[model samples]
Target chain A: MAYLILKDLLLQRNMMLLAFAYVLLFAFAFQSMGDEGQLVAIISMVGYMFVMVGGAWEEKNNSDTLWNSMPAPKWKIVGAKYLAIPVYVAFVTLVYAVVSSAISLLQIPITTAPINVFVAALGTIGVFVAASLYYPVYFAFGYTKSRYWHFILIFGIVALSSMLPNLFPEKPAWIDPLFEKLPKLTGDAMFLVVAICFVALLVAVSFLLSLRFYGRREF
Target chain B: MESILELRNVVKNFTGFKINGISFSLEPGYIMGFIGANGSGKTTTIKLIMNLLHLEMGEIKVFGLDSRQHEQQIKQRIGFVYDDNHFYEELTITQMTKVLAPFYKKWDWNTYNRYIHRFGLPSNKKIKTFSRGMKMKYALAVALSHKAELLIMDEPTSGLDPIVRSEILDILSEVILDERCSVLFSSHITSDLDRIADYVTLIHNGTILFSTSKEELFEKYSLVKGERSLLGENLRPYLVGYRESQFGFEGLVTDKAAVQAMLNGNALLERPTLEDIMLYCTRGRAV
Candidate 1:
């Protein structure tokens, strides 16, 4: 299993410089959104880029035939993609830190976020959400077909994020009660446990769906 | 003893192509040459056996176990090499092997390194830098190093030069010396099989023409050449397929003795190679 993840990392090794460039790009683009938004954008965009590139490598190499012909099971192949998500997340986080540190040391005018467990957790969750939606399509239809959905998802998020303020000029009445209850919920450590469990459950369900879809796929 | 591999009434369908109830089996300790024209379902059948494609009907058995139900177990013992290089091109063979070696229960690094050294493959070079023959040799090295009992190769020698092809064939011949290993080598290059195959299975139009021993195949079919004037109505039944020209005529004949007797020293009867057999059986024009 680790080998499978390592394979993706090795394949992506040449792109490390490109990945650093992407970090700088995303940092520049999201600078106006302040630290949290910039951090989340860098983590999710760069992390998801890894996932897409990994899938592309499989298609380009036509490697499903290789893996399926061997003793490796479908579940392991599907599971490895999900497992690698966090690794990608960790990598992007590290890159963001280096870039942020360099900006700080050099007194660059770029706005940067501090690395904290909470913000990093949010970024990781963001990646999980995107991957959960994207992978099922990828496994069902392969990379070539699923890539359109990836574009749509990205566009939809951008469109929705921009439209949300317009759609609700004022906060909904229900959000007020929920926001009030959120502080009390956060006061207890149980909320963190529940949130982690929720993300885990989402990932587990996505993994199962991907496994089922990939199981029926023919190389 | 159970056959090393078996397929009974296996059927698969695509939009315009189908493998129509194909059946053949290979025993242990031998090489079975799967010969077919392009798009004749050789690769599809191989994929079916490897469970890379879902079987629309019938059964595939490897080592007496159901292929789908026992896929992992069966695959552990089966090594495969396809025509195209499927390993990651960006990574060196050393890195690629590190990722794949753990999946096979019996993977032997010593055997792998031995084959690599023997094949003269560079360990540190990315696969993209390797020549077609080197890529194929790397694939073969991985396939052989796992202690595989069944080696399923689809067009492994298709695009290689004669020297490299000969090298692969030699390794295949040596691998079969174990007496426990069997090979199903699929190729359009019939000459490779002529030198190494113990059994030959011919497929045409998604159907199995015949699956028999090489000696039996040679005995059953003969290549006949003679004057175009010798072509007659009575001899039409024996000719599988023949072509005529201003100079002479040649064809594959199922009944060599009858054709020889009919021609009466006017025609020459010779043992047909697998290429002749495949060509006549699949593409030859009747009469």
Candidate 2:
């Protein structure tokens, strides 16, 4: 599994450099806008790009057939791919933090927050969820065949999220209390605990689903 | 005899083609040549044995272990080489080795290096820079370095110069000299199999035509050529893939002795080659 992950990393090593350069550019551009939260989005987007690039490289090279022929269980191969998501997210976050810190030390007038671990964790979680949703579908249909489905998924989520509020302009009476109480719950430490558990469960289920799809796939 | 690989009544189906219930086995200390035409299910059968493709029916066992239930364990002892290169093309040979070496328990760096040196492969060169033959040599080096008990190669000699093909055949012969290792090689190049194979399994249109010792196959089939006037109605039933030209008629006959008796000095009977057998059995004229 470690070797498989290492292989993916090596194949996508160029992405790291690209991500670093992108981070530097975005940081410099958004520094004047005074938006620090965009750094998290940048990191998340880079992480997402790594997953797609890795999948594309694998498909182009037909590495899945090679990996399937190796002495590893099919589930382990799929598990390694899922495991790479967090590893990549962490690497992207690290590069962003480093670039942001260098800009701060040079006396640039950027809105540099001191690398909040909580925000980074949240960003990683968000990217992981998105990847988890995408990768299982990618594995099921492969890169070329899954592109339209991926477009549909992204657009469907965007459409649904944007339409829900317009359709229900009058907040339901039952939902107002829950929305009112949500911030109070988020401020409590136990909320972080619950969030972590939920994210972990989602990731676990996603891994199992990807594994099931990958196991049935023929090279 | 200890069987190293066994397939029993194996069946796989696609939309228009099916690998119909084929069964064959290879014993240790010998090479089995899997002979078939293009799209004749050779690669498909190899994929099935590797469990890359799911089996619709029947079972495959490698080293007496079920291919599916114990795939990792079974694969640990098996080495595979495909017709096309399957490694990372952008990575150098050394980098590719680093990625793949740790997967097998018995990988020997010295053995790999020895092959690298012998094959004249540049360690620092990217695979995309290597020619087709060089890539195949690299694949063979990797396959051999793993101390694999069974070597399964699919059309490894397909598109190579004759000299390079001969070199590969020589290396395959050397690999099988270990006595504990066996090879299941598939190719349309029957000449290569003629040089190295001990057992032959011929498949055509998703069916096994014959699986027997190479010597026995030669003994059973004969290439008979005679004057066109001698090809009578009486000999029509015995002729396979009979071809007629302005000068004579030639075809493959299974019962060489009986055919010779019937012809009685009118026809010239020669030992049938693997190519002759494959062509006659698969696409030969019936009468």
Best by DockQ: 1
Model 1 off-target regions past 4 Å?
A173-184, A187-191
Q: Write the per-residue lDDT of candidate 1 for residues A1-219, one digit (tens) a residue.
A: 899999999999866668888988888889887777888878988888989999999999988989999999999999999999999999989988899898899998888888887778778888898999999999999999999999999999999989999999998889888878764664425665667788899898989999999999998
Report the C-alpha lDDT of model 2 over B1-287, residue by residue, as the tens digit: 75899999999999999999999999998999999999999999999998889999998989999999999998989988899889999889999999899988999999999999999999998899999999999999999998999999999999999999999999999888989899999999999999999999999888998899999988888999999998888788888778888999889987887898999999999988889889888997943
Cα-based lDDT at residue B142, candidate 2: 94
Q: Write the per-residue lDDT of candidate 1 for residues B1-287, one digit (tens) a residue.
A: 78999999999999999999999999999999999999999999999999989999999999999999999999999989999999999999999999999999999999999999999999999999999999999999999999999999999999899999999999999999989999999999999999999999999989999999999999889998988888888778899999888889999988778788888999889998899999989986754
Complex DockQ per candidate = 0.92, 0.80
In candidate 2, which residue ranges exceed 4 Å CA deviation? Answer: A25-36, A101-114, A160-165, A168-170, A179-189
Give me the displacement of residue B138 in model 2, in angstroms. 1.1
Error of 2 at B114 (Å): 0.9
How well does model 1 score by local distance difference test? 0.92
